[model samples]
Target chain A: MILVAALPQQDILRLLSAQSHPAIYAQASNFSVADSEAILSISHESSFWKRELHFQQLTQAARNAGSYEIGWDGYDAPKPSDDSINQGIALLNKIKEAGLSPSSVLPSADGGIGISFRGQNGRRALLEISNDGSASYAIYGKGHPRLVGEFSPTAANLAVVFNRLSENL
Target chain B: MKPTVQHLSKAPIVEAIIAFALEKPLTDSDAVFEQFYALIQSDYPSRNPVKMAQLTVSDQGSSGETQIVGARFASADGKRVCLVDQSNFICSRLAPYETWESLKSEFERLWKIYSPLCNSRIARVGVRYINKIFLPEGEDMSLTVRTRPEIAEGLPQSMFNFLVRLGVKIPDPQGVLMITEAQLPTERPGFVTAVLDHDLQFRINPESTDVWSLLDKARELKNDYFFASLSEDVIKEYL
Candidate 1:
């Protein structure tokens, strides 16, 4: 359903450049180097059962969300911009290295991407990264209390959150 | 299967290639060819030579058909050839193949001459060897060809001929080895000729000078993978 028709390489670049996110545009003046390196790192040498590669493929499928008129969900959702996808993949690489994979990697309504981790007792931690290179996380459960804040999307910080989520589960 | 071998006395290698893909067409390609011809013209005398392709004729007779390769230089026997153009430099030794060392030595010898003639901006380099083994009719194909195509159920269970290709990436040096296994057309009435082609290629720095080591290592990997993909019985037969 997430518009899987692949886009040409040049078209993808054109789409990225056409994005109106001024803050994200200012942060990343170019996507060529980042796109090539990040995509190659995940795809260069890989095998089945490699946890990190799943997210990378998902990111590609999300990036090619241009064939259909997406965002008909009424939220006027646009595909995650290049910055958001890059950060999301980097974060996923770290998490996957620690043997933690997200339940789903989906485009956010805010032109970003959300990686969700669901644990026992309704404990769920959703990490959302926006196109402006900003990341926020929300952890809540039915019986467990809520923990929410602007989290640094790094491996060390992810481990701290995973520790707390594992305890509640 | 024996996973390794130093050198097989009866290495079924049909064709061995030391191929270089240039980043772009050479400047003044016509003049560049003249410069290269001066160096290799003695060893490889013929110009624009044709390599023979073995074809299974409809009458069951086998014939060697000539395929016109553009701007090719060949030895008198036509077994050795250097096919050159604006964007490619492909040196090949057909059938009765020799050692990998000989091929690399020949490449290095000519590469020296060609490199100086044109500023070689190699985009990719490959060490490819194609081995052919003939199995008697009704023999189990898997004995010589270990790779098989997997088809889901309810599909046609029988196939006339098939080819399987596997791409393996080497992470350390950032290279790719593509292995192709196929049933080739043959003249032998009661035998099936199978082709096992292992092509190990990698993108290299255009200015990198240590290409010989890269090629040597790639051939090692290709040889390893080639033997690993065969059955033990086939190795014994070829040995």
Candidate 2:
């Protein structure tokens, strides 16, 4: 749980300012403290998958480690791969094993995905969206599929996202 | 196993790696991923006046009704493809809706704050659905009102009005702005080139007076290249 809470933008800046690393700080320094903090806050709230958290932590760790190559991936949690294709596969696998009814995972001509699943009732759930190498998802729902909304990259937000999506089902 | 788009696109070196990986003579799956990565990392120009920072709405366990923004840039003939992701509540690179009303109000409010921050002359500004756009007359820029249901484009009208006030000429007679669901594939460099080329083309043609003025203004802005992905080195490499 890489402290997925959203700190105030000012606080994020203040923390970054105190960091020992200069290059990472400089790269991130341009963002207003408010923006940085908000993104972090959202990450914590969203339950980001592990890789997203690692990406966030990698910057701080690089600064802390005094090397740009260092990556702070929080492997503590069962974080999924950051690769979109792999994540898509992982998601499909999870849905399949969860004993949920048969669903179709359609690939878009544009390299995106369309997931169609049927609930115990006659309702249908469709998740059609894309990604940006970050934790961003746009979900729309119809019938009684349970959840509908968007998910964006932050720190530790995937768990929350999974719960929000499947808990009700 | 190769580098992910996020890994390569982040600043502080890796540009050369990206360029190297994406260079021509692409082969097999490895080459295909490289090509795809390049497309994902390409810089596409966004004419929308509303920055992501201003439009973000909070989601606090509410019904969470919001539209997602999506953008795809390509050549006029549709060649290279660049796909850009939208910030959750942040800047929208894609037109959320096909109508002008959706964006008019938000654009208006954002214009109030962003206009001073910009010195660029406005090109044709308004709700753009693919190549098509809905624009208002010169006088409409001032009289425009911001309302919830009015922004069919899901953009603020003020932002559109501000650009028109700054000198952007919206295309009229309607044919110039065509909207469709066709996804255009474009790489980052291709996208930037398209925008620059489109603006320059407009300037050379006398029929593009309004758009010309806006291009001139943008050129004079403090950071013309802020949104561009290719540096001089990258351009030189390709040339």
Candidate 3:
């Protein structure tokens, strides 16, 4: 058995939350340390697990960066602000409350986080939350014109968007 | 609603699987040999079986040395099997899945044989189902409404290849379900093979919780996702 250093409790919590994208508590979840490490490894193959592997890599990279800052896609991207992470967490909670799962939760290049949803009907929706508590959305469906708008990250508004996406699911 | 025989299908959608986890790494592979052999010998009498090994290779491309670390036991028919290591326990049905009930029963039987030998408890449990949907010959992939339009659109005219994965928390049964749909590589003319994989998983204290309940929940989620993923017309035609 390969013995990797056990992550700290707080760090584990943060990593789990980031990996699950809905702020999942560590106590309520059963996750393999090996699987987590595999996800973080750059050598791992990408498949259906790609979104999760990327999230784990982001979390580890953020931890290595120190001070809860996330590197947005390895570029010289803006460091995610604490406020942005919190807002992203809040948005994730809202997404879950609406019974919707985003395809991925990724840190944006502009000190924010973005959640994406794809439908089987060629519809796609993205919800991006910035550090300033502002949010914007863009939705596109096959044959139909793309819809772009801004909305507060409230449960009701997120539900409306989630419902639209679910229609295509 | 239970799917009928015509809809349920003997030609299973799932191709293969390896679903299990370990609480702690096993130190001795020989500790459970007697029980393991006794349990599997009935189904798999073959003398030659693959064993898991640890290998060390030099960066200079020299021959690598292998050391046995674990073992995998397979049924004579090769349909059912179990893989065991210090901390991990995985069992899989390679192909032609009979039913969830059979798989669950087999898992339970194998776990019964394994639970006594391993000292550590089960920390996590995950059930993954891989479904392969073979499109009819000459059928336009776009014309099939089995999946949501967002996932079906924007395909190359000659070869349509795409992958969509989503992870959602199951509020009722208390777990996470990861759904993935992708186009598979195929050589058959005018045929497209799409795979819809559902991985329903949860972390739990194996000692306190009932494994059967979790398996039931996983099956429920699988059924829900399967039917929900397809259009009524498609379900009627191919389910």
Candidate achieving the largest TM-score: 1
What 10-residue stretch in candidate 1 chain A is worst by lDDT? A1-10
lDDT of 2 by residue, B37-71 (tens): 34433332211121123243556533433442323
Model 3 Cα lDDT, one tens digit per residue, B1-239: 54332446544454334355666666666667556777678885532333433456677755644555556676755456676655566667755677777777878878888877876677666677766665654454445534432423364334344555555677766666666665543424555556677777666676756866777777766777777665555566554
Q: What order do you get sorting by lDDT, best first?
A: 1, 3, 2
- Where does model 3 sit among the CAPRI classes? incorrect
A48-148: candidate 2 lDDT, tens digit per residue: 11112223232232223222121223323222222444445444434433323224554333333445555433555554334344333332345553456
| Stronger candidate by TM-score (2 vs 3) | 3
Which sections of candidate 3 miss by over 4 Å?
A1-169, B1-7, B16-18, B33-35, B47-69, B136-158, B163-168
Q: What is each candidate's DockQ, to 2 decimals?
A: 0.01, 0.02, 0.01
Decoy 3 TM-score against native: 0.50
What fraction of the reference interface contacts is present in each model, in order? 0.00, 0.00, 0.00
Residue A63, model 3: lDDT of 36
Interface RMSD of each: 17.2, 21.5, 17.6
Give the fraction of true interface contacts kept by model 1: 0.00
Worst 10 residues of 3 chain A by lDDT: A1-10
Docking class of 2: incorrect
